[model samples]
Target: MLPARHAAPLQKGLLLALLLSLAACGGGGGGDSSSPADPGTTVPTPTPPSGLTPPSEADAQRFLSQATFGPTQANIDSLRTVGFKPWLASQFQAKGNLYSTGYSDAIHKAGLKDFCKQFSGFPNDYARNNCWREYYSAEPLSREFYRNALYGPDQLRQRAALALSQLFVVSNAEVEGTYGLREYQQMLADKAFGNFRDLLKSVTLSPVMGTYLNLVNNSKADPNENFARELLQLFSIGPCQLNADGTLPGGQCVATYDNNGVRDVAFALTGWTYPAGGVSPWGSSGWKNPTYLRGQMLAVAAEHDQTERKLPGGGTLAASRTPEQALDAVIDALYQHPNLPPFIGKQLIQHLVTSNPSPAYVARVSQAFVSGKAYDFGSGVRGDMQALFAAILLDPEARGDNKNSDPNYGRLREPAQYIAGMLRALNASSDGANFYWWWGNELGQIVFNANSVFNFYPPDYPLPGTDVVGPAFAIENANSTLARLNLATAMLYWGGLQAEDDRPGATGTQINGSNWLALADNPTLLVDSLDKVLVTGGLPANIKTGIVDAVGVWNEKNHGATWREERARSAVYLVLASPEYQVQR
Candidate 1:
């Protein structure tokens, strides 16, 4: 029931060609040095800054802020030699074998090919292959912990908690055969460096994303607004007028909306569809198997709705338009909007680097976006990844060091971040049945199974009377809150420890055998590890003290060896679950 804006056929062809050219040319490469280096070889370390033997706390924090999930000891060591800026530049241009080889191979083996094969054909005989469906189809080990909370043995709880946490952040490589998978992996492997615009286009046409956002079946006649709405509201320019500092004018609270603007933009996004010659259904007569054609989400003229549409505020476009005109208009408007740079740049900083970047910091990042000095992947000037990392680490506001009672500028780690961090930390593989088991439950972020398209939780859930943008204030009702608390407790006791090692004939033998406190006995090590992996270098002393005290209780009671491990594990779960972890600056 939304208004529609169909582009002229001529315009569609022109835009499609332009996009193809840009994609082929790698867009405008941003201004970073284009000298290629061997991705397979490690760069030699630089001398420490003026007699420094190891990285300082500041150095560690900077490293953690930009890397996906958390840093490994190896990763930290590498950063020490390259220094932050150059290391960041290298990440932007990184190539093959960058991820752990074992992990990468296992991901490849996880029926990803089958999934890709199934998704290649759409809107015809092609079977639907929902990633979420695949994930939940298997009964992950974390579920047992949930069951234990309700009826099973209390002793089995901590194992489940760790499994859940692991599941929360791990990225699945199930897109192997799908056309979009390669592109997405390229973006990720590019060290989280790429053009935001290119990333947006890639996500728009990706089968996983198309399925996630319900854009697959969108047609001219019955134009689905789901993708269009989110593209503007969550993924791009965002929903309001804003100052350059990322703060809204008039000091308005979070969750404000430009309802009319959303509607107008959605109208312009009409008429997008897959290529002509509809895909063949499996076993159907005259049906042909569909192959993935790169850049093939074409606008079918016959399928397009050419009705003249009224804009939300009051304007009209001519009827029977082409796809190019419609899409270009929307993208251009969004790109030029004043709100875009600050709004999106801040979110990227929040997701990739820090929680609470200062207004000035946001301004600097946004300026890069606007001026085309940063995030311009076409020129290869350090793609979105390099610009974003620079903004997060180098910006003065981001490095503000007032620790005593400073307002926390971090975001609550989404389930994905938490899970991925754990898997990376454990060097776990997704091919095993234990995939996503340890972290998913602990953090409550199950991949491919967000509760709604609004996502696991609203990005701007408001707090009581504050209208402040923080953690899950919007969705944390009584049931959810209780669930969260119970989830936290369960994670500590059951999710942290792994189940009896699954070696054949292992006979229920406990691994790390009931000594939950073992990791916690050395509070310094535990804290340091958590700081290294979870908080980067930015954990508050008070928070560290709380974890230490909790560890003490576990140690004193001679808690089961398993319980001891759970307590130590709980320290991390607790930190990740805290309010401070959820709100990115």
Candidate 2:
């Protein structure tokens, strides 16, 4: 049930319209697993940095839907003008906004000092938890993420970083110190387009990741296997062996590494402590440093595991080898492992393009991951993210009408994507201070605060009563599905949140209803415009008609001077509430 305040905004008729739409498309009711495109059919390939244009506006919207936080009319126009390959090139060159260091560090420090001083006492300790939430926790970082995602020039970079964040899997829920968390995310954003090996090493040595996985104070005497186990099972390779195309070999779940191998890797990873600058709240330092998160985990030679160890995939660390040497060997073996390509590539595809990508699609992306360059990129570097993304986005399966035709080609829009997409499509603006955390909390995905290391939902999550996978749908339920409708009604019918006065530069979140209001008098035009902006192909005729008829009920004579506003709100509310808009094809 909605709080009394929100109840009034969602009128009964609108609720009925949404519920009817939900009955048709919600509940993760995915269609069969038929391929979106014929196995032999080839999409018109975009020549990178040159000849490529979206065949239609729907196609352009579809591409942006996959690659960005959400599509905007301006962005659509820009993409149409520059073409696909060129737009991707520009995004690759676009400067990234960093979260962890420099400016953000100053903000985090100030917020901590300011908020932590407000309350004094046990349990009512505002100094501890309050300060963390107000400034130093995932709250502040999540706000910045929305700002970048909503308006930053580097859309693809941010999106890639989000995907990488899930795979690398560090969260403020387990690891604290806002500075460290910000820096951790910054590293992911910075390297989102860089080599996979560099990213893997960075994740391995990161203080935030170190803290989350218990690697920070690790020593040969008490090495932690948490990081080692996840590095293989979650980050680098899966538990089962894959055939280069992401399919399990012989339809068998072969183990990638054993418990013994995990222990060996843990021993190899020992001898790391918090970075040097951290001072414990009690003023401790060195090996016992409090959780300082600003820099890479420091190496302590004396605590190193000097015994020989065999890496899981291949390679050996001889006795007397330095900690750095052993660490290098472990990373090298993992980076060169055959499992890295398809395991990482297929997941990337699921995140960016389709949920169940064809084996051929996975193989194509895997090949790109291995080569680390694309013909379009012309950069001869290995593990190139730019090349990999180009391969995924430009693939025929990601574009064309087949994406809509196939019953199983798309993914349910996760809460973040759904909210951001709606706001972006309706020309929304935000200081990004609160809606993300508030609404995201209500919807079960609060960014940097995922429920666990496994993430909000696993990549292989199967839709209910179906063989199809829709990872985002894992969080959807009776309550969340209704909450989605409630959120839409609030944004479209009522005004969105107002800016927080205490937050510097906060605009709160709001959409330009005027854009929709302008066409409200003509119900068909309003619905069509929304259909173009919000739905990926176009709204199904029945759904589109339902929204139009709902809007038409609010003619001026019957509904007074505010009729247009009512009609406009009804149209947007109904579209967002529909299952068609929930899935990103």
The best candidate in terms of lDDT: 2
Runs in model 2 deviating more than 4 A are 1-54, 96-130, 281-286, 501-505
Over the stretch 220-298, how does candidate 2's per-residue lDDT look in tens digits? 8978799999988999988988877777767788998999889999999988887765433442344556556777888
lDDT of each: 0.43, 0.74
What TM-score fits each model? 0.59, 0.89
Q: What TM-score quantifies how close candidate 2 is to the native fold?
A: 0.89
Clashes in predicted model 1? 88
Q: Tell me the tens digit of each residue's lDDT in model 1 across 134-215.
A: 2222222223222222222211112212222221211332222222332333333332345555555555655445544555
Candidate 1 lowest-lDDT run of ten:
1-10
Q: Number of clashes in every candidate structure?
A: 88, 3
RMSD in angstroms between candidate 2 and the native structure over all alpha carbons: 5.0
Residue 118's lDDT within candidate 1 is 46
